[model samples]
Target chain A: MDFWTLANALATGLLTGLVYGLSALGLSVIFGVIRIVNFAHGEIMVMGMFFALIMFRWLGLDPLLSIPLAAAILFVFGYFLQSTVISRVAHLPDHMQFLLLAALAVMIVNACLLIFGPDPQAINISYSFDSFDIGENLIIDKSRAYAAIAAVAISGLLLGFFKYSRTGKAIRACADNYLGAQVVGLKVSHLYALTFGIGAAVLGAAGCVLLLLIEVHPYLAPGYTLLAFVIVIIGGLGSMTGALVGGILIGMSEALAAIIFQPSMKSAFSFGLLILVLLLRPQGLMGKSVK
Target chain B: MMGLNLLADLTLRGRICLLIFLAILISLPFWSSSYIISVTTITLYLAILGQSWNLMLGFAGLLSLGHALFVGVSAYMAAYLFSVLGLPPVIGIFPAVALAVLIGMLIGYLGFRFSIGGVYFALLTIAFAELVRIMVDHMGLIGGTEGLFLQVTEADRQGFDLINLRGHPWMFYYLAMLLAFLTLAGCRTLLKSKLGYYWQAIRDDQDAAQALGINVFRYKMYAVMYSSGIAGVAGVFYAFYQNSLFPESVFGIERSIEISLGPIVGGVGSLFGPVLGAFILTPLGEGLTEFTDYLQSSGLIDPKLKLNGLKLLIWGLVVALIVLFKPAGIWPWLNEKLGFSRKEGE
Candidate 1:
């Protein structure tokens, strides 16, 4: 392809990748702290998107403005979820745990189906079509830039919280050694709830941002879950930085694949990339070795 | 000697149960409505799929999230052969099964060779399945997005065409029943053999199995090959029975879940688990939809409101509850309740 087209695709890919990375980061945080892969991740994200959509429809709030509201709501849900149902299944085998979360995914998706019909929902701000030229060749959409900026800001905030906050350290301690934390009298279950809540908040904000770029529907939940998984595995499961980097790589490849091949083959391209990463380096670029 | 081989796992009581069950199935068409016959046929189809899947996932601990790939590939292969070259499905099924086995080997090689197990291995299978589905969506010769079709005349629907594989529901029903019996017998025989023992070894603990001199990689591949081959068989039958094939309908992850629900809910790694699970789930699931339809038609519920979601909500809840409470499934518990010994090698 021409240099201009290539650069444009690259820019767009990076922007979309930010949002994708943000979504995967939510999953990564969950896996990192709990060592439990949330199979219902995509459904939860759809929940966040719906949260945003509902607010936008009823309250005339911009999707961008509704990000924190969605995140807060999701955080509470995640907290209760971890404190209750997840605690019960935490002791099960990996496959059983996966199935349990997947079941939860099914329930959540169906709940959406019952609440809102199967039609895709979207937010149509006045600038949905607005774009700006950054350089001689590269043009970016207004929504894409805003979403990317918001993603970076939230990611930074999350990282800072993980690094600097006492609650973050306690959660990390539990992840480092749950037994050790319990030995030291840390409220491990409550801490786990906090971590899950934060992870969910990340996804919730991401859902709000995503609604700007695409439509939301219950059926779309699984595909997003798959996408987050693809991103997380590529970056290395349970690695936050890995999620970001993996997201960009997949985003770029998919964008370029759309230009190189048929648009429908974009997912195939990412999956091919995932297979390569899985076979060549199952641990991922930034993650530790798989035990 | 022939009789002994047939009685490999079954006790005398079990044999009596089998005969009685067979008699009931044989007499079903005489008394039951066409709807029940068709539903039973569907249950049988699910039993076959679930039994095949259990061989790999339950027996070898190979979690395949994309099993529909095998079914889809086999169905499309058989459908294409029949539609293009006018070959009968009975014959076309061989090549299709062979292809499915090859595909199975490809996935197994990728998974087992790399030592990818558990959910990671499952993810690998998903990638391959999704990849194939996308590629197939673009291909035009075999009817890409629009899907492939088989010809059916008004006469073909009412009367049986045993030769060309076009037939009435009775033909398909009998074929499904035969396949179900074959799968049950095949699994039973395999479980009694050395290969089945080795497979269960790998499934329960790979490292320990390897340390004990069992070739974990080889046996796991065997599980995948047999499972995928059987899935292909079901696929070929499904293609011809439906007289049309759609990519998403056969290859989608949802289809894979549908295939797996029987084995999982009925009980995994047990021979009769898939059968029992299929019998319970298929009828119940069909009934669920029918009940929703009833509500919509009777104006008890909003006609415009879609109830499939509510149905699925209950379905997922049931699956979750089963996984939580009856992890071993209902079959083994019932088997024990009736005083039959457990079926697994260990």
Candidate 2:
């Protein structure tokens, strides 16, 4: 009933939604360009979170500070994985490709479980408890606000890179028409690997940001994977801008639902929304209508 | 049995092999240990579920990741009816299957009508299952998160209550075997029918099938309905056998994955693949659990360490290797090893 409580939840949801948008942006970019959905996207993101956590424990580094390292590590892994394993299945049937990724997801999640055990892992940042007064009685958690700001900055950088950089433009060209790119002497396969690397890197950065909001556990991989898929599908599977918007919308809905009803209703609201989108607007909010 | 010549195409050697296998299964409880009986019961349950999934995936080219939606919904329906409404599962299973067919049609219609084939269709089905799961989790009428437990009495436990589908473990084992055989035969019959041919055409190439004058949409719907109907039966068996229903255990992605693995591992597109897959993977799963228990009991590992994830991890590796090296599955390879080879498309 209180105005500020509702306002604060909305604000927090907006912030968390931005981070989710960034995470989904990773999935969207790869699909848009390579036309291959990274079924193990969430597992890769979880690995990034564990990377951040490991750095925090060993070197007393903030998760935000470890973002670059995690991104770099996952980038290399993603690049190699696509070139080696995923490339083999890129031309296979859709279900086979999905199975391959799910298999990878299984391997990654269990590997993490074996290494870190099945317990929830989190970090203690000094600003976790700190909040900022936005005006009136409304307040936003400092870490959340910082995460949102970082998310926006990273997303902006990605957009700029895509819009202006040579490699980014080449990736876009490939997305538009890879055969054309290959005919023009572009190394399509290497570019595909690069695009996948960038996708993994973005997911890694988002994972680092997510560590500020929630704890990570090995079992959480599938849920996050499903959540990411929901976001991308809602945003229009291959649309980057739409993915961000969809994430925001999903986060806002879940936050409001949590405030209004039980927290368990969050998934219900999101999934229901997904079904509606799939039925009524398969192209998504910002995607062009497909013929 | 239906005059479709179900085994006319099968070789005499294959028929004999099947007869021997059937004999072993029919007499398993009398000679096998209690543990093996229970394991075989679980395996048979999984085989039917896997077969149902394979109908859509392998036969119709519909890759549904949430086939457990049928299993979960039907199981919940029967469980709720039997426990809350005092209806026996025999009748309860009817409504359960009806709902599953309706849901399957809705999913198929949405995906097929909207041109959402491939992975998008898969996601659509997942959304339905997850939505239902969350809804069931909040509804207290079905026990919500606390879960539904079907009560068992001394008589129900010690005696064979075929009417109620409750009794000694061996009774349930026999029930599972019977259901498995029934479903296997049903799937075989369907596969050899006109509907199965249409389904195969669609799976091989939809545009080509349409060009050839096949009613693609109608046949695809039939595939979904028939597949889900079988899955519903398996769900009823699950509700009675387990005597417990939790949304997560039944409706979650894990169950869906577990059900799909047998066909993928055994040999997708083959009639016996799901059974072979169930026979192979279920024992491995049981062995993994037994190994973990042994390790814990022998004090070879830390008590607090949860090694259960490794079992799934191994499955992941197996699937990945299979996808890479043995895309056809294990059954066909096994057939070759056994000095018998299937004719193309057989």
Candidate 3:
């Protein structure tokens, strides 16, 4: 590929990777705190996207401005789900827990399909079409740039919260050692609900930004769910920074792969990379071995 | 002889029920309409797939979310051999089974060798299935996304043609029934054997199994191979029964999820759980579709209204409730209520 073309692919890939990172970060945080892989993470993201669409269309609110509202709504929803349904199965065997999440995924996706219909919806603001030319050949969509900036900013805020906030430390304590956290009189279940709520809030923000970039549909969740899992695994399961790096890596690889091969084969590349990383480094690039 | 011995072990009531169930299955073609026959055929095949999945998930304590990979691979293999090579499906099935087993072994080796168990193993399987689906969609050799349609000759379509597996609905129905019975018998025998003990051991506690001198990896490989092999056979049946193979319909995550539901909703690890689950789920699913069609046709529902999403929503709710309430599944609970002797493996 030519220099400008390569640079353009890298830029697009990096930008898209920011969104992927943001999405994967939700899954990472959920796994980190709750110790349960939310199979419905992408569905939750799609739910956020739909929520944004609703607010944008019905209330005449700008999609970007609806981010906090959507995040708050999703946070409450996550807290409810964690406290009610997930906590019941938290003590079950691994397979049962997995099946519960899978069932939840089915319920959420199908529920969305029932309510929203199967049609793909997109919000077309003025910025959705606008792009800027950075140099002779490289061009970036304005909405995507804004989404990327939002993703980075959100990641920063999440990192800061986890590092400096009291609730964040409590969540970290619970994640680090569930039993020890309990011994220290930290209400483990409450902490879990809070962590899940934060994770969902992150996804809600990502969904608002994603609305500006792509179409939303019920079936959109599964692909994103799989991608998020791959990114989470690649970045290390519980590491926030790892999720960002892994997302960027996957995004760049997929973009470059599309240029090199058929566009359809890009998913294959991502899955292949996932399998390779899983086989070679189960602990992930940024994760430390627990054992 | 073994079957007879198994029959002898059951109570007289149990034996009678077994005989009656078999008789009903055998006579189904005589009294049932073609629609019922087709549904039953699908249920039987689903039972087979569920049983196969149960071997890994229920017996070996390994959950695979991408079993459609085996099904899709074998179905495509059988379809390809029959269409491109002009071979009979009966002959095509061998290579299909072999290919499925090969793939199963590859996955098992990669997974078990690296000690990848639990949810990670499930994710690996999902990734493999997706990768295969994408590759198959792009490969022109398999007709790409347009899919490959198997040709049925006039003679084959009209009567029982064992070679091409093209015949009336009853022929496929009987074939499916036989396959289901054989799979049940095979699973029952395996569950009674020493291998079953080793599998249960590994499933319950892999470290303890290793400490007790069981080769956890080899037995786990055995479970996967057997599971994939059975799934491959079901795929061959599916190929001929459907008379077409598409990458999306066969290899999609939905297909995997559908196959797993039978075992999950029915009861995992029980011999009859998959069969019972298939009977319950297939009829409910098909009945919902039929009901929706009836509503649309009878003008009760608007012509423009789409009911599939709603049907799926209800189905999801049912599955969720089942998972929440009866995590061990309905079979074990039913077994207790019916006063049947709950065998250890069963």
Which predicted model would earn the best TM-score? 3
Residues A49-143 of candidate 1: C-alpha lDDT, one tens digit per residue:
99889988999888889988889999999999899878887887666677778888999999999999899878889889999988677799999
Candidate 1 structure, TM-score to reference: 0.96
List, residue by residue over B53-140, the lDDT tens digit for candidate 1. 9888788888888889999899999999988999988789999999999999999998888888787888898888888888888889
lDDT scores of the candidates, listed in order: 0.88, 0.89, 0.89
Summarize candidate 2's per-residue lDDT along A180-281 as a digit string, tens digits: 999998999999999999999998999999999999998888898899999999999889899999999999999999999989899889999998998889
- Tens digits of per-residue lDDT, candidate 3, A1-291, equal 788888989999999999999999999999988889988888899999999999988987777799989999999999998999889888777666777777788878888887788999888786778999986688998998999999999899999999999989999999888889999899998989988999999999999989988999999998999999999989999999999999999999999999999788898999999999889998789987766
Stretches of model 3 off by over 4 angstroms after superposition: B5-9, B293-304
lDDT for B244 (candidate 3): 86
User: For each of the candidates, what fraction of the native contacts does it recover?
Assistant: 0.71, 0.70, 0.61
Docking class of 2: medium
The positional error of residue B272 in candidate 3, measured at the CA in angstroms, is 1.0
Model 1 misplacement above 4 A: B1-20, B340-346
Top DockQ: which candidate number?
A: 1
Off by over 4 Å in 2: B2-6, B292-306, B337-346
TM-score of only chain B in every candidate structure:
0.94, 0.94, 0.95
